[model samples]
Target: MATDDSVHPEARGLEVVIRTAPMPADANGNGDIFGGWILSHMDIAAGVLAAKRAQGRVATVAIDAMTFLKPVYIGDLLSIYGEVVGVGRTSIKVRLETWVERQRRRDGSLTARQSMRVTEGTFVMVAIDEEGRPRVVPEA
Candidate 1:
């Protein structure tokens, strides 16, 4: 999981693939949601894109430059987006971004922004053959 070291705004060319609300059980002692949960969502988003491009099975081989910008809380809506930035013979690099929309406070005032990017990372996915091993990726 990436550390909450820095943050940035959303950009274009990224595909939004996952969105869900955080539950109470998904949080830690600090009441902040876990980072792994967010990362898993991002992986799922990347996997969907990778599988489509690979035209078959694919597995994550590496993750590069993961950075978490903010902490998510319960009742917040989580959204993840990813895009295939690079493609190799058997691997693809997906740039992913995660965001959250927290519910407003009781006073009706804006408790949080509409969409806050929590984390971003580059996930490498390898195209796999029927035997479940790495295989050549088709030309795009």
Candidate 2:
């Protein structure tokens, strides 16, 4: 698994693909956002990029090298960043990173406003036709 340290600050400015706040229902028993919930968001973000690259529908075929560096709170604003790292005849590999901008405290304190990287993974998506058959990725 790739660690957060593998991500550099300069390269972290990739376009944000998905940004949303997690609800209490998405939290685990420990009051932190569930890992599966984060994975779902990552898939959605990666799919968005994949579809754009494939210029059509795409489906996730695999998730590789996922690493969770920190826990996400329910109130945190989750931001997923993705980019097409590789492309094949019918497959697109997207590198995705999840970050969180924690919500303010009840006391209205202005502290802890910095965003933190929580998780990251590479998603392999394949272009598909209407009948769900693999299609060739168009040349860019």
Best by lDDT: 2
Q: Candidate 2 versus the native: TM-score?
A: 0.87
Assess every candidate by TM-score: 0.85, 0.87
* CA-lDDT, candidates in order: 0.80, 0.85
Q: Which clashing pairs does model 2 show?
A: none
Each model's backbone clash number: 0, 0
lDDT of 1 by residue, 56-87 (tens): 89999999778888888777778887778899
Q: Per-residue lDDT for 1-140 in model 2, tens only?
A: 35344564237567789889998899877777889999998999999999999999999999977989888886788888878989999999999878777766534466757677889899999999999999999999
Worst 10 residues of 1 by lDDT: 1-10
Q: How many residue pairs clash in model 1? A: 0
